[model samples]
Target: MAFVPAPGYDPAYDPPVPYITAIPGGLRPGMLFYIRGTLAKGYTRFRVDYATGQYEGSDIALHFNPRFDGRDRVIFNTFQNGAWGEEEKKKDTPFSSSRPFELVVQITQANYQITVDGKPYHEYSHHIPMDRVTWLNVKGDIVLQAASIIGCGVGSAGSKGGAVGIPGGLPPMVGPVCNRPAIPFTANIPGGMIPKRTLVVAGHISSGAKSFIINLKKYSSNDIPLHINSRMIKNVLIRNTFLNGVWGEEEKDIQNNPLQKGQFFDLSIRSGDQNFKVYVNGHCLFRFDNRIKNVQEIDTVEIQGDAELAYVFF
Candidate 1:
C-alpha cells in the first residue's frame, strides 16, 4: 500500500511498524530528516528509504541500510527503474543494541549529509532529481520512538506549482523550522523578527569546550541588538548589545552556569514588545529590554565558537 500522509502533520510521528509518510516539503536543500529510536536487542538490519511514493517498487533516492549480521556495515544506495544502484558502504556502525540513537540527515544542493549523535557520518551526492523524491519509508529491526523532519523552511512544502506537491499544508512547526545546521552558522531571520518572534538555539557543548556566542545583528549594518556569550572556565554568561561598534553595559547576573559541558541545552530568545525573553530548558533565564527600537530591522542571527549545533530556529 502507498503511504499517504495525514494532513497538517508528518506521519513519522504516527505509531506503527514500517513507519511510512510523505515529507512535508518533499526533499529540498536545507531540509533535514531526523530519526530517533532504539535498535532491538536482536537487531539485524533496518532500512530508511526516501522514495517517490508508497508503491513497493517505486524509485528510492536514498536507501540508508545498516546491517548488523551480514557485513556489519552501513550501506547507502539508490533504486531507479526497479533496480538497485551500486552499493556505497561504510565500515563503521554507530548504532548500538538496547540503547537510544539519533540520526540526522541534512539535505543540500550538492548532496545529503548524515550525522549520528552529534558527529558527521557520510555524504551522498544526488543521482535522482532531489525534488522528485517525496515519500519517507522506514522499516526493519528498530523500535521507532520518534521520527521527525525539521528544517522545512518557508514555502518549500505543500507548495503548489511544479516539482512535487505537498499534500498536507506545511508540517506543523515545533518552532522556527530549522534543520540540523553546522556550527559557526549564520542565517537571516525570516521576515525580520517582528515582536513575539521566538528564536531558539540548541546544541551540545563540546568536551573541553571554551566558549560560544549567539548574536542577533542587523543584516546591512553593525548594530547588534542581542549578544549572548557563554564562557566555560570563567563561568559567566554575558549579555549586551553593540551599536556603531560601541558596546553597551554587560549584564552578567546569571547565578549558575545554565549550560554544562557535554550536555545538550535548549535556549530560547523570544522577542517581546518591550524586551526579548531568554529561557533555558523552559525556565526564564534572562530578559533584555528592547535595545533596538525597530525589532523588525534585526535581520541576522549568528552562532560561532566551540559547540556542536544540534539545531537553530529563527
Candidate 2:
C-alpha cells in the first residue's frame, strides 16, 4: 500500500541535522516511516534511533548505525540502562557518501523491516518493547531532506480474518488503489466513517486548475457531511455541509493555503470524535467541526475538478 505522511504528525522538510522529535501516537505495528537525505561527503558514520525518551542516555529501542570507517557495515543494537545489547551487523552498506538515499522503516509485530532505495535491506528483531518507543532521533553526517510517518494498515505482514488493534477495531477498508484515476472520481467508504479512520487522496493539480472539490456524503441521501472546495485562483479553501437541500455557512479561515497549481500533494482527512482534521502535504491545514452528528452515515467520497489523481485510500 502506498503510504502518505500520517495525519496529526507533520512531515519534516529540509530539517536541520541532529533532529529529534516525538513520534506522535508512538510506534504501532502498522506504522511506516520514510526518511530521505544525502550523506555528507567523506562521512564516517550516521545513526537513526527509535528511543524511549528524547534525552541523552535514554533507552533506545532500536539503533540503526551505518558506518564507513575502514569497513562499510551497518550495525543494529539496543541500548538500555547504560548498556548496549549484542550487536547485529550487516557486512554491506547500501548507502554512499554525497548521494541521496531513501530509507523506509516499517514496524511489525516481530521486527523492524528496513528498506533502502526501494530494496529490502534488513530486519532487526525487537529487543525492547515497541510501545515504549516514543521518540525518533537522527544524527551524524547527513543532510536530512524529509521524514514522515504513516499508517499502512494493521497486520501488514498478512494476517487473515482477525480484528486489528487499531482504534476503529475494523480491518482497514483501503480501496481500489487506483493509479492516475480519471478525474471526477468517487469511492465508497465501506463500514462508514469512524473516529481514527483516515482517508488519503494523492494527486497533482492541473497547471491551469481553478478549483477542486472533495465531498463526504451519505450513500443513500443527498446530504453531504463535509464539502471541501479549493479555489486556486482566489487562494482560498471553503468548507461547508449540505443538509435538507441547503448548504451551511462556509468556513474560509485557515493558517495559510498549501495548495498550488501544478504541484503534487498528499491530502489526508482523519476523523476525530469532535471534528475532522485536514492535512495537506503532511501539514495540518485546518479542522472542521462536525455539522452532522452521525458520521457513520457518511459513507461515500466524491472527488471532482481540475486535478490528476494518483490514488485514493480509505
Candidate 3:
C-alpha cells in the first residue's frame, strides 16, 4: 500500500520490508533521500526502487540493486511498460552482510548522485522523468532501519515553489529527521565542507552522561577543524580545533547551556566564509572562527559519547 506524504521532514524508522511510501512533494532538484539499514547475514541481494506507484508491476524510474551472489556488484536500471532497460553495473559494492550501511541519493537536474557511507559512489542519469516518480519501495534481505526524504526546507511537503523562508528572512535549507544511529558513528561529507553548507545533528543525551564530542575532521587525517565537546555536568559547551596534535584554546563562552540529560536537542552548524554558526533548538548558540583555512578538506564527521542520535544530515 502507498504511504501518505508527511510535511517538512518525513521519516520511517525501523520499517518492515517491502516498504513503500509516497515521495514527499514528489521529486525535485536539490532534494535528497537518506536510507540507513543493515544487510541480513548471508544476504545475496536487495533492491531499492523509485517507482510511479506501489503496485507489483509499477514502472520504476530507478532501480538500485546490489548483488552478492558471486562477485559483489551493484546494478542500476529502469523499468517501463513491463520491460527492463539496459543495465548499468558497477563491480564494486560498498555494502556487506551483517554490517550497517548508510546511503544517500541526491536528486539533481540531470542525474541521481548516490553516496554510500560518506563518499560519492555513482551517478545514474535520468531515463524516466523524475517528476513521474512518486513512491519509494524497498524490499529484499535487509533490516530496514531508517529512511527519510529531506532538503525541502521549511515549506510544506506538497509545496512546489521550492523552499520558503521564515518571517525574518532566514535561509531555507533545513536538515532531515534521522533515527537512532550507532554510537561512534562516522560518515563522509559529500562534496566536502563549503560555505553555506549546513550540518544538523539531533539526538537525546543519555541520563547522567559525562560529555559528547562532535568533530569535523580532515579526510584521512588526524586534524579536526571543528570540534564540539559538550560537557553536560559542567554545563559548558567547548569549541576547539585539534591541529598538529595539539588542541587550540577552548572557546567556552556561551551564555546558556541548552543540553540536558535525557532530553532531545537539535543542533545545526552552518558553514560561513570565516566561521561556523551553531544553533541549538533553533536559537543561535555560538560561532566558531574557521581555524582550518581549507574548509573543503574537512570532510568527515565523527560523533561519539553519551547520546542516542536521532539523525545527522549534511
Highest TM-score: give the candidate number: 1
User: Candidate 2 — which pairs collide?
Assistant: none
Residue 124 miss distance in model 2 (angstroms): 0.8
Per-residue accuracy of model 3 over 18-79 as CA lDDT, tens digit each: 78877755688877787878897668899999998879898998999999988889999999
Ranking of predictions according to lDDT = 3, 2, 1
Off by over 4 Å in 3: 1-6, 152-210, 213-314
Angstrom error of the Cα, residue 138, model 1: value is 4.5
Better of 1 and 2 by lDDT: 2
RMSD of 1: 7.5
- Give the per-residue lDDT digits (tens) of candidate 2, residues 127-236: 88876887889999888867755553443221112323343343354343443468789888887888657787766678899998999999798799889999998999
CA RMSD, predictions in order: 7.5, 8.7, 10.3
Q: Over 4 Å off in model 1, which ranges?
A: 1-21, 34-43, 53-59, 78-88, 92-132, 137-200, 218-223, 230-258, 266-272, 277-288, 310-314
Error of 3 at 196 (Å): 23
> Clashing residue pairs, candidate 3?
118-188, 178-310
